[model samples]
Target: MTQAPGDVVLIGGGHTHIQVMTAFGRRPEPGLRLVLISDQTHAPYSGMLPGHLAGLYRRDEMLIDLAALAEATGTTLILARATGLDLARRQVLCDGRAPVDYHLASIDVGIIPDLSGIAGADRDGLAVKPIGSFLARCDAILGAAVDEGRLRDVAVVGNGAAGVELAFALAARLRARAQASPPARITLIGSGPVVATLNAGVRRHIHRALDRHGIARRDGVRIVAVEAGAVVTATNERIAADTVLISTRARPPRWLGETGLELSQDGSVATAPTLLAMGREDVFAVGDCATILEHSREKAGVFAVRQGPVLARNIRRRWRGEELERHRPQTAYLVILMTGDGRAIAGRGAWLAAEGRLVWWLKDWIDRRFMARFQTAI
Candidate 1:
């Protein structure tokens, strides 16, 4: 079936896609129509996720109601999973619905946490991506830990910034639950230095914070398997844990293998600097699901947030037969890690690193400001 001549379909309700919706809402195109296809009704704001886990923010406060936003913007919202795309027909294929046609499409569905290679993880480990489910799982585990009435050991697998903050958040939650009871033991297990890519000072600050919180650090050990009540290391040493959390980096969604678009080494859609899928102008990809073919950057939320404006402008420009704008991602952006204790670790550029309650306030201000951009008018 043919859609309107100017129908632009957004494939996910991610950060960049939300910007597109807001742009169209604030400015109208006489004949253009917008449709957003989202598998979930709520979009989690990345900056506030850790805070949510740490009980700093309520769940609803950290989630954007995509349905409401779509209604406010006059965009059709399809609550269905996009299985794949029929690029030849300019249509999106869904799980149980007829393909929807589009003149242009953008993808911002986030990456899946790769756990296929880790033995026993499927049954015993909890993944930290698809943040909503992870939070729920953590709650269940927290309940179980409370009933146990003893000091429980927790293992966080992965040493990146995410894994680190998750460890801290879990520690705070468990500590609060224990009160005068046995204090929970938390161990961060990884194969390398925590936030290995950051500067020496930043890593040191994180280490100091971990020490301050009494969280044990286990480095140079890869978690080979997650079993019931314990995690087995590469050398077969077992670390006892009541809960195991997997916070590994991106693993391309299995369905991406079917998409004809070019993909990067890590299996994300290969997008040009302009946020367009390489060799396919009709399709634009951003956020964690896309990889910039040139000037490679980490799949961090900063890039997606920065790309939103350019993506909106480029789409409008192309529709109006104007020149397109290329998105230039900053080489160095600020990094803030919440310690779950009213304090935060922050790093800017390459040389500076600091930790304090002031840093947490700064981070909170920036996060609230970003949310306000969409929340205030909607």
Candidate 2:
């Protein structure tokens, strides 16, 4: 069945785009049709990612079923990767189909792990950027560990939230496995201080969590190369590991750079306060792929989730010839870090850390509730 031309084409199933889908589902604009284009049928929510890595949540639990979402939202779901964009033509180019024509387009394709310059990164280490690929590789690694009855060593490169969460999750999982046998030695290497963007209290809390898990932390260590069983640092230090997870320097999808859209120095799509492309009014962008001026926050799922309503409103307004509303992100939001067990740390700014199973429970409840909102109603 052919869709009578859509008003807006959303590129990618990232958090922000998903929110747009949900909002439009609840209250759709009759004239402004929405189409969602994504490579994955199921897009995982980033908040529950650490839990998935630690084997706490099943794949289904962590992922949002985009097919069902599209069905409920009355939006077209095209399961294909966006290869390019014709800004002047106001169309989206896909890998294996006719170029999709649209009056407006929003890109939330997310970021790709930057590993081109790191020697052997593309060849040896498994990049943890595309969540779907990372999940598959993680399964393989876990399966091998379970079969061999031991995992030698695992290295997680990067000091940001993703890296820290993944490192702790791996450590927790390995420790749990070791309780039954021998544990795998895990090391987290970072080029700068861990959680450098976070407040001091949050940083201290994470450091304590890492120590508690017995996961070794190496700071100010640049990864020069990734080898078969070792990661060489810029200082000529070699750290041995059986598995290497790349988790730093996220770059915008290459296609964005090639599309000739106004881009930030880092290659992110430049957008206005309404999240529309800088030069093209018909084009909008969100998530890690966008560089929104005025309120540039670190690439976190929270920000992406918050942008959904604004994006939805703006998209509809664009079709109706109405002014768009600007999105204002919270100056400070609560950060809850999971320990891969049934515990977590909650803190903001410089303050003592508070720990309890309740925090974990709160996190679980919050994540589950957020995910349930998007679950296909049977």
Candidate 3:
């Protein structure tokens, strides 16, 4: 293999980097080498993750094969965890490998649930991000319940979309498989109204869904600690549970803060609208790891997907000494919430809310199409 004149290193095989790599694969840039450093070779598509838990899709169906993508795109994939960034030296430090150097670099390392502050959560609770680990543990827990022929009490912390969806999905999956014991008891604990970020109509719909499933809901309650067989609230009320799942708000990797790059208050890499790291031209950050300074938005996958083309374009423009383009995110975008059953709710801002099996089918179709792109030669 020939060493190209310039090296473009992408850390983390996140959603944004997927599009970047796919685009470069279709149109290779001569004299430039592409390298991807990722801890996991397979990237899970988040949209289908809940459905996968609900038994609607298989594990492989929801994952992007990074190794295959790398081979197709002519990118060298390094299977190592990124420890830190050497901005002054233009290198990526890894745990067990030599430092990777890059003339141009971009980071799309996604976030994880911040459970460090929660007492005993690290030891007793299962986090839902880094999807693979959660999936594996989910299987084992559910498998144990099935094999033991006993009902299990499952608790989910956080009332956000991920937490609510996961709670319902877990209930649906457990109910589908009949055990000799009684049905599993699922409880949703939240610091505020569950799905509060969504529109009122959507929230009402989710509440109704929870009621129909006979799932317990605890709102406006703060969990002070997680115990072996239960979670203790601030008021010392103990909520009994056999398994605890965490789907709290996103938090950037701690290493990102250690890089000394200008970071947002939440510890995300602060970047200009062009997706370049703030005050730096050679480095860029995207996805959950980045905070678009000009038009800050919540860490969402939709925004990251939208940033992909602009990021790739800006990277090329910088390389060619051309003007960079700014990426302006939409003020409001379509929001789709899937019920564990064959139903989904679709809303665009607060103006519209529709729900039915057709909506779920539409979501399923959209998810499958997005996944098929990576599964094939593209």
Which numbered prediction scores highest in lDDT against the true structure? Answer: 3
Model 1, poorest ten-residue lDDT window?
A: 1-10
Q: What TM-score fits each model?
A: 0.96, 0.95, 0.97
lDDT of each: 0.86, 0.84, 0.87
Runs with alpha carbons beyond 4 Å of true place in candidate 2: 1-6, 179-181, 350-352
Off by over 4 Å in 3: 1-4
Candidate 2 local lDDT, 262-330, one digit each (tens) = 898789988888888887778899988898776777777888888888988888777777888987778
* Clash counts for the predictions, in order: 0, 0, 0
Candidate 3 lDDT by residue in tens digits, 196-307: 8778888888888899888899999888789888998989999998888888866888999888899998999999999999999899999999998899987777898888
Q: What is the alpha-carbon lDDT of model 1 when measured against the actual structure?
A: 0.86
| Clashing pairs for predicted structure model 3, backbone only | none
What is candidate 2's CA lDDT for residue 143?
67
Tens digits of lDDT, candidate 1, 18-59 = 999999998966677899999898888988988888889988
Model 1, C-alpha of 280: deviation from truth (Å): 0.9
